[model samples]
Target: MPHTLAYIPTPAPATPFAVGETVEVLDREHVVLSVQTIKKVTRKKVKTDCGREWMLDGEWFDGESSYPFPSIRRKA
Candidate 1:
């Protein structure tokens, strides 16, 4: 029996929503504006060149209030 290697995938930039990195969320591309950490919880503020914002958690979980959170594509 062959053992399969365990691979831990990581998002680009090693840090989510890194400043100046282009990312795609919900099929749209935007650049990271800034990242904020409050009480150890991280949040990323991303916006488009035109000032359009696609609000999302740092983890890319866009679930509704108290709803099930699912992982989405971290980058383009």
Candidate 2:
């Protein structure tokens, strides 16, 4: 009898929002200005009514009240 090798699959990374996309952040809506990827890290530059800000994917998982991830949506 021959034994078969088991193949393991890895999950794909999540995609970041694109520029000109509308995102709801901090109870307000904003537009994604840019998406930067450095060293496998993805950061989004967003423009809101208050001002422009940078957001990272890790912020959503972290338990930091001050830094929260915003709800991203596509512009219709």
Candidate 3:
């Protein structure tokens, strides 16, 4: 038997962010945390102007593929 890593995509939808792009951070209740531009972006990290970061390739998930802290969204 072979081992296969399962990654069932989270039901929550989050917008992937890029460097120099503005985004809004929201709490579990969808309350805004902060609105700022991305300082740095990578598969392991996404740093914001406010010094907040989330590590994930697709939106807001950590190395463990779990969503930690605030979620993100495009600036309106």
Candidate 4:
């Protein structure tokens, strides 16, 4: 079954995620990366963009820093 999400308003400049979008949570302190599937979690996590699901254990911020993924990169 598909997962349902909640609504949340994560402020702009922080909102970079979209529903059904894939993201990577960055672990700055430990230099580790965690991939996350984003879905609207709650109204608080909501933005013009969608929230996340399948979040890996790492550090992520919605409004301050860019989401990071180390293992994966855009093809050139």
* Top lDDT model: 3
Best-to-worst order by TM-score is 3, 4, 2, 1
Work out the TM-score per prediction.
0.28, 0.30, 0.58, 0.33
Off by over 4 Å in 3: 1-15, 57-68
lDDT of 3 by residue, 1-76 (tens): 9965533332232555678987777765556777888888876678778775665432465446646345666677
Worst 10 residues of 2 by lDDT: 57-66
The lDDT for every candidate, in the order shown, is 0.35, 0.35, 0.63, 0.35
> Which candidate's TM-score is highest?
3
Clashes of each: 0, 0, 0, 14
Estimate, for each residue in 1-76, the C-alpha lDDT of model 2 and write its tens digit.
Answer: 9965432221222656544445433222233433332222234443333343434432222232423333333333
**What lDDT would candidate 4 get against the real structure?**
0.35
Against the true structure, candidate 3 has what lDDT?
Answer: 0.63
Model 2 alpha-carbon miss at residue 57, Å: 2.3
Model 2 steric clash pairs: none
Residue 9 in candidate 1 has what lDDT? 29
Q: By TM-score, is 2 or 4 better?
A: 4
Candidate 1, clashing residue pairs?
A: none
Off by over 4 Å in 1: 1-14, 27-44, 58-73
Q: Candidate 2, TM-score vs. the true structure?
A: 0.30
Cα RMSD for candidate 4? 14.0
Candidate 3 clashing pairs?
none
